[model samples]
Target: MRVVVVPPVPALLSRYASLTDPVPELRAACVSAVAWLVEHDDARIVAADDQARRIGEELLAQGLAGRVASASERIETRIETGNILVMANGSARRSEKAPGHLDERSFGFDSEVEAALAAGDAAALGGLDARLGAELLASGIGALATLADLTVTRAVMDYADDPFGVRYWVVRWECAS
Candidate 1:
């Protein structure tokens, strides 16, 4: 089975850094983000197997609540030379007036974390998983499973006030060659 796992986007450094704070709000946001994925980001997700797509559709449908609006969104998946790119896999507020934009920001890693990914250190990556996971959880986003294949990602979760909101996250996973 071909599976694509997305972990937390890396750009949310400040929001996620404070582990001491009790971030009940962030945890709830993570759940909503998952459900949002199924609803808004289906088009970008691709699986060579039809069964995988079917499963994805089911999960997406189940993610919707009565309050969530029906979206005409799509998810895209592309295979590059040594990595896989999964993008446009979440919600966005498409208003012309206040088009909340999100950018691909690399993880502002401290020297230690930087050295690890740069040097292909597995232990370093594992260490990052713990630290990053805590940060993500603090930001109302949860870290999903980390793939054995080394994939890095950068994404943004941007939104305005209550009624209209835009939130999304993406993670790049290296597929076994």
Candidate 2:
């Protein structure tokens, strides 16, 4: 199984794009990750909400040249060959310019999440405190928790940064079948 993790940055969507990409590197990373995910005919998106889900869907539509399966949650349970796209980010308080402003606790929290992702530590990812994540403006906890059920054999960190004071990562996880 393959799972790709990306941030739910609105700037990634074309509708919210600027004349000059404020997150050029991030955008390239996201597009590359999404393109990889859509290599298969189908993909299951695990997102925080409807908006996040839409971002995943749009990526598929764009990357796959409009060939996209209707987004469905049940497809994951029904198929074993498709990819999983997780739309989540670490925190929005990594710096004073961060969306949630500077929070002393945010750095530690994001570091832990980053470590887990880099190490492919499912246990650490699953054990993340959802409440504390919310407090720290981390939106990826729930999706990370779901990874506990899977066995991650390898993790490829395609991107990791806090460009807008928001922690973002583009990672690909190769899981055991």
Candidate 3:
């Protein structure tokens, strides 16, 4: 199994894009990460809400277009099977400019989440407090928790940053069946 983790940054959607990307590197990383998932024949998406799911779908669509254009034969698109694409992110209170404003606890909260993701510590992720995550404006805890039982064989951090006070990550995990 393969999994890709990304944030539901509206800027990732072309409709929300500005003339100049506010997050150039992040955007590139997201596109690249989603493209990797598109390599699979199908995928299941996990997100916090409809909007987030839409973002994931948009990314998947973009990836599919690219893939189809390069493929030798027609590609079939399906849903809710194969690799997993999770739309999630850490705290939004890391700094004064953060969406939830500065919270001294945000740093530690984000650090723990980041560590879990980087190490593919499914137990730690599953044990994360949903309430605390909400208080800290973390959006990925629920989805991460669902990964508790998966045995991750490899974890790669394609991107990690707290730009605009919102912690975002693009990580890929290869899990054993």
Maximum-lDDT candidate: 3
Sort by TM-score, best first. Answer: 3, 2, 1
Q: Residue 155: error of model 2 in Å?
A: 0.8
Where is model 3 poorest over a 10-residue stretch in terms of lDDT? 70-79
User: lDDT for every model?
Assistant: 0.31, 0.81, 0.84
lDDT string for model 3 (1-177, tens) is: 888899988888888878889999998998888788768665678899898888888877777778777332322344546688899998899898889999988888888888988998877888888898899888867988888888999989999998899999999888898
Name the regions of candidate 1 deviating beyond 4 angstroms.
Answer: 1-33, 36-43, 64-67, 71-151, 154-177
lDDT of 1 by residue, 58-143 (tens): 33333433224543232222122222222121222223321343222212322333343234342454444443423322111111
Worst 10 residues of 1 by lDDT: 136-145
- Show the colliding residue pairs in model 3: none
lDDT of 2 at 147: 85
Residues 1-177, model 2: lDDT tens digits: 788898888888889988898989988887787677666655678888898888877776665653444444434442444578888898798888889998888888889988988888888888888898899888768988888778889898999998889999999888887
lDDT of model 2, residue 124: 88
- Give the TM-score comparing model 2 with the true structure, all chains together: 0.88
Candidate with better lDDT, 2 vs 3: 3
